[model samples]
Target: MSTERAREGLYSRVQQFHAEQMQALDSGRFEEYAETFTEDGEFRHSPGRPPARTRAGIAKELTAFHQERFAGEAVQRRHWFNMLNVQEQADGTVHATFYVLALLTRPGERVPEIAPSCLVRDVLVEEDGRLLTRSRRVEHDHVPEA
Candidate 1:
């Protein structure tokens, strides 16, 4: 494929991967959410301290974290990505960086609260004709005071 075409294909794959992750999160499918990554993938949440080093770890940590943080609070959450920059590696892997905005809506709240935007850095590899994340880093653009 030409350079342009290859870039376009990578872009589409990243977008699809992001969408699938958002869907998993929205539906509270923690296991599916974690499965979006490779078996040894890692998810590092900025303010949360320790990182999830594996898919199982991600599911366990995220499930407990979300429950503790937002338990019993009916809310709508949406994660959006913008300004994605994708690069194809010599080994055929892809790396991308983008900004993320997370909007949260709570019951009785008039407007949704926007989590400070963050930067997402991802490394994805094509395995068996499928794109899978090998590493994901989420850095807070602005962290709220606790």
Candidate 2:
């Protein structure tokens, strides 16, 4: 494949990956959310926090986060990612940056209000014809007080 085509393909897959992950997590499908990553993928939410380094660990964290933040009957959250940039890395992984947002809807809400805005960096690898996240770094732009 031409280099440009290869990048386009990878970029598409990465976008799909993020979309699936967001859907799974938003719908409380924790296992599906974890499956979006490699078996030993790393999810670093903050520089000072320990990374979730395995699928099980990832699921655990997701469960906790969802329950604590969005479990109330009146609260709902939608996660979204827009591909901002894509590039091939020297280590045979695809590096992508996504403009990420989490919006919350409450009981009286007409539309979801944006809460957390971030730039998410994903290092992705192809495994068995499926793209998976090897590592993800999330940097926040704004986080409204809950």
Candidate 3:
């Protein structure tokens, strides 16, 4: 395939992966959310923090974090991604950067809390003819007050 086509294919695969992950999160399907990553995939909420070392670790961490943070709170979270840039590596891996906007809706709340969009920096690998995330770093434009 041409370089352009290859890049496009890689981007499409990554987009699909992100979409599936968001859908799983929105539906509260923790298992599906966990399955989107490779066995050794990493998920980090911020750039300075250490990434979850494995898929199981990520799943466990996220399940606990979400349950505690959103306990008994009805809310919908969606991630909007844009400005995708990808670079193909010699080892059939891709490095990507994309901006993301996370929208949160609370129960009976007409307006959602719009977070300052963040950037998603990720390393993707083609394993067994399928694209999988090896690492993901999320960097916020401005840290929100807790």
Candidate 4:
């Protein structure tokens, strides 16, 4: 395959991982969502919180967040990725950044409310021909990094 074709293939796989992750999170399959990362992948939900790197740690945090976010509420949640930009870095890792919209739909609500929108940067690496998130950072709007 030509270099261009190979690049396109890589892009497709990354997008697939992103899409699958969204589905898993939205459907409340927290463990499945965590599985999208590498074995030692890390996530920093906020600057203050310590990163979660272990598989069990990832699952634990995700489950806790989901429960707290939807506590005592019957609603559907969705993650929308906008303007995704995926690039191949010189170091052989893929850098993906995009605006993320966290939407919540409550009972009797016609439109989903935007809980928040943030910029997410994901460092991805191909493991055994599949893309996995090596690390992720999220920045909420107007929140200056410390």
Q: What TM-score does each of the candidates earn? A: 0.87, 0.83, 0.84, 0.87
Tens-digit lDDT string for candidate 3 (5-40):
544466687788778877887778876776777888
| Model 1's TM-score against the true structure | 0.87
Off by more than 4 A, model 2: 1-8, 46-48, 143-146
Q: Per-residue alpha-carbon lDDT of model 1 for 61-130, expressed as tens digits?
A: 8888889888987777888889999999898779999999889888788898888799889999878877
Order of the predicted models by TM-score, top scorer first: 4, 1, 3, 2
Off by over 4 Å in 1: 1-8, 108-110, 143-146
Each prediction's total of clashing residue pairs, residues at least 3 apart in sequence or on different chains, is 0, 0, 0, 0
lDDT of 2 by residue, 1-146 (tens): 56655444666766777778888877778899899889999998754567888999999987776677566575767887775698998888988887888788888878889957788888889898888989998887764322
TM-score: model 3 vs. ground truth = 0.84
**Tens-digit per-residue lDDT, 1-146, candidate 4:** 56655455666777788999889978988788788888898998765778888667888998877678678888898888888898999999999999988889999999889857799999999878777888998888867778
**Model 2 global lDDT (CA atoms, 0 to 1):** 0.81
- Cα displacement (angstroms), candidate 2, residue 88, comes to 0.9
Which candidate, 3 or 4, has the higher lDDT?
A: 4
Instruction: Give the whole-model CA lDDT for all candidates, comma-separated.
Output: 0.84, 0.81, 0.80, 0.85
Candidate 3 clashes: the total is: 0
Number of backbone clashes in candidate 2: 0
Q: RMSD for all candidates, in order, please.
A: 4.5, 4.9, 4.6, 3.5
